[model samples]
Target: MFTGIIEATGVLKELTLKGGDLALRVQSHNLDMSDVQLGDSIATNGVCLTVVAKHSDGFSADVSNETLGLTRFSQYQKGQKVNLEKALQATSRLGGHLVSGHVDGIAEIVSSNSNGRATEYWLQAPENLMKYIPYKGSVAIDGISLTVNAVEKNRFKLTIVPHTAQETTIADFKVGTKVNLEVDQISRYLERLIQGQSSAASESTLTTGLLAKAGFIK
Candidate 1:
């Protein structure tokens, strides 16, 4: 699990083909790598990647075919900047909402405009995932936790402050930029619970007319 809080920014250094999958190296001068070990997970642009090899200035991880299909990783270019966040520690602060680092889908930036010291952006999410994005709800874009300022159709708005833009790769956002998106974990669980209960209730003998007779409805 991750907190969706970006710890530093990293650059894609190299891409190597390993077997049928791809291995990529990320270099960051600001991120702490002193205690990192093999098999540790790191949230890279909101996608959880396991550490296969550690380096002095960066690390290498293999990207599976499933991840490439669900995220914008396939379109990434060499030297592109990426958001970086280490997995949550036991004593870590809950700075952002719980993020599984399992991106649901990709979202595209529809528009980008300046809002005083902040940058206001409109992004179009996957139609199926739109239901999970509510006004003022939490969402992780490229692994950076942000609040939804507004919502319309399949699009949502995010107001990125200067600090956020400077600390992460959001500053590189532009119209049509594809980003990894992860919705709040709680919403997904609630949806499953509701669906499961509804499915079980299908065998009930009570109906709307029965509810009216019982004074539960008018």
Candidate 2:
């Protein structure tokens, strides 16, 4: 689990294609590497990546084909900047909403505009994932916890402040940029509960056709 709070911005130093999967080496000058160990998980651009190897500057992890196809990591090139966050600790403060670092789907930045000291961006999400996003809901965009300012059709709005831009990779966003999106974990759980109950109700409904088919009544 994670807090969706970006600790630092890291640069992709190398992307080596080992066999069929790719191995990534990220270099970060700001992120603390003292406590990080092998097998530890790091949220990289909202995707949970396990640390296979660690160095003084950064760490290296392997990316599977499924993750590559589902995320923008496939489009990433060497030297690209990425947001970084360590896994949440039991004693860590819950500053942001719970983020699984599991990318639900990718979203494309449709538009952006300056809003005084902040920049407001509108992004179009995958059609099936839009129902999980609600106005004023919490979302993790590329591992940065942000609130949904508005929702229109299949698009949602986010207001990025100067601090956020300077601290993470939000400053690099542009129209047509693809980003990993993780909706509120609670929302997904609630949806599952509702669906489960609906399914049970439908199965228990006794229609005349169902009764006749089952030979229970005629």
Which stretches of model 1 miss by more than 4 angstroms? 197-218
Tell me the tens digit of each residue's lDDT in model 2 across 140-193: 999999999999999999999999999999998999998999999986675455
Instruction: Give the number of colliding residue pairs in candidate 2.
Output: 0
Over 4 Å off in model 2, which ranges?
Answer: 197-218
Candidate topping lDDT: 2
Residue range 122-196, candidate 1, lDDT tens digits? 999988888789899999999999999999999999999999998999888999898999998887775555446
Clashing residue pairs, candidate 2?
none
- Model 2's lDDT to the true fold? 0.91
Question: lDDT score, residue 88, model 2?
Answer: 99
TM-score of each: 0.89, 0.89
